[model samples]
Target: MIVAILGAGPAGMSCANACLSFGLKPVVIERGDHLGGAQRSNFHPNLWMLGFPGETGEQMTTRLAAHYRELPVTTHYRAEVTRVAASGDGFLLTLAGAEGVRTLSVQAIVLATGTRPRATPALERFAAECPRAIIGPLSDSIRDDIRDTDVLILGGGDNALDHALFLAERGNRAVVCTRARFSARKPFIATCRARGDIELREHCARPELGHGNERVTAAWANEQRAFDWLLVMYGYLPNTDVLAAFDPAIRPALSAGGYLHVDAWQRSGVPGIYAAGDITDTPQPSVPTAMAQGLTAARAAERDLVKS
Candidate 1:
């Protein structure tokens, strides 16, 4: 049986691996040329693969890419999925990309499109004008050029704190503006709090960014803070727009956060459709967890295909 996997990231690659192991054909499609989505840019070292240490995220992703290449999986790179429509027995995917528009039919499709950094409404107006100042998760496109700069970060979650710590360690002064208490774990919070270089501006409100000299300037509380860069560490959101054309029943399978709601077997409420990775409403969002979910989805697909 053919299993169509949207995304060739860690989760999608793991799903393809599992499918091959179960004697099934897997097709992996990625919007980007690289297999790793955010993992490739991750600065952290060592992933959850037994006792192997000192391995960077990029290294681990490269290893996974090598493993995937050795498999019999058919991969389509630079393919942008336009929409998904329900077919007679399964689904039809419409893609418009480097290869032009094409439609593919499959019995089951795994939604592992993953998640991207969410933009905050407060600085929405300034983002388009000062694109270089805004830093999003999975995107390190402008980091190297802005080293040792003062950045004002907005948010109080795990992502916010992580960026704050990273910037501080990289010789940049980062001020985190958050009206609410930190949503990150105690360990991360403590590590960030312990840093003297990183300043946490609790109870900050209406933090905004202004564009001048082709860069971002800080504007908050009737005063403009002197900062060379602005880094907003808000959280992420799933890329579920491709499913907008899906049946009405499919919409309810997604959670409020736009993540697909799946069961233990990674089966969405909609039949012949499964979701894994950061796109799913999993309690924890990490590479190891995403890989496990991918494996589960593949096994579930095998079982359901046999039953049918």
Candidate 2:
């Protein structure tokens, strides 16, 4: 059986490894030039990844890529699936890359495309016109040059509060504003509260952002503040737009938040299609959980193929 995994992130890599173990041919498709997905930009150590203590995300990527290089799985880097259609109990995928366009047939498909930072229309407009605007914390754009500065963060999720702590450690002051109550972890909320450099605000509507010179001015609810940078950490959205390549009837069900809906085995309710990682509506999105889901999806694909 041939399994086509759409992504080169942790989930896709794990799925490919599992497929090889099951004696299935795995073809991994990646839109990026390399693996690890958003993990590539993570400079902080991933405490959630067991057995790899103190290893940063970049280091972990290098280790994973090294092992993956030894595998026989076929890979397409800097490529994407442009189209997909049902083909006799399987799928026909159209791919476009530097080599131009081509097609492939596979018995099963794994959607591990992952997620991206959520954005609002106002934020998008502001970011386009202001150089001090940043979408998320996991960006190289603000990695080194953004120290000892004042930052304005939007959101109250774990990502927002966690990065507030990171910025504080970097000698920067941060002001966090959320539309609703703080939904971040208790530890994060408490830690941020204990810090004098970080200010947390709830029930804040979208701020009016204006830029001048090297700084930005944010006005919200009768309060005006100036910051060196504006970091919007409104959380993530699953990258399920690839599903548009398939007919509506073939597309898997999606949650209200646009994440794929999957079962215990990672099956997408649609036979021959499975999803893993941030693409699915998992309660907790983490590296280990994505890896486990990918492995399970591959095994489930193998079992169903064998039964057929």
Q: Give the range where candidate 2 is weakest over 10 consecutive residues by summed lDDT.
A: 136-145
Decoy 1 TM-score against native: 0.91
> Model 2, range 153-174, lDDT digits (tens) per residue?
9999988998899889889999
Tell me how candidate 2 scores on lDDT: 0.90
lDDT of 1 by residue, 1-308 (tens): 78899998878999999998887788888988888776887766654666558787777888888888998888889997777777777778787788889988887888888987777665555666676567475255665566787778888897788877877878988888888787777897888888888888777884555667655666676777767777666788897876775657644367886688999999987877888899988898888888999999999998898576
Q: Candidate 2: deviation at residue 268, Å? A: 0.8
Candidate 2 residue 20 Cα shift, in angstroms, is 0.5
- Alpha-carbon lDDT of model 1: 0.80
**268, model 1: CA deviation in Å?**
0.6
lDDT of 1 at 46: 53
Worst 10 residues of 1 by lDDT: 135-144
lDDT, model 2, position 69: 87
TM-scores for the candidates: 0.91, 0.96
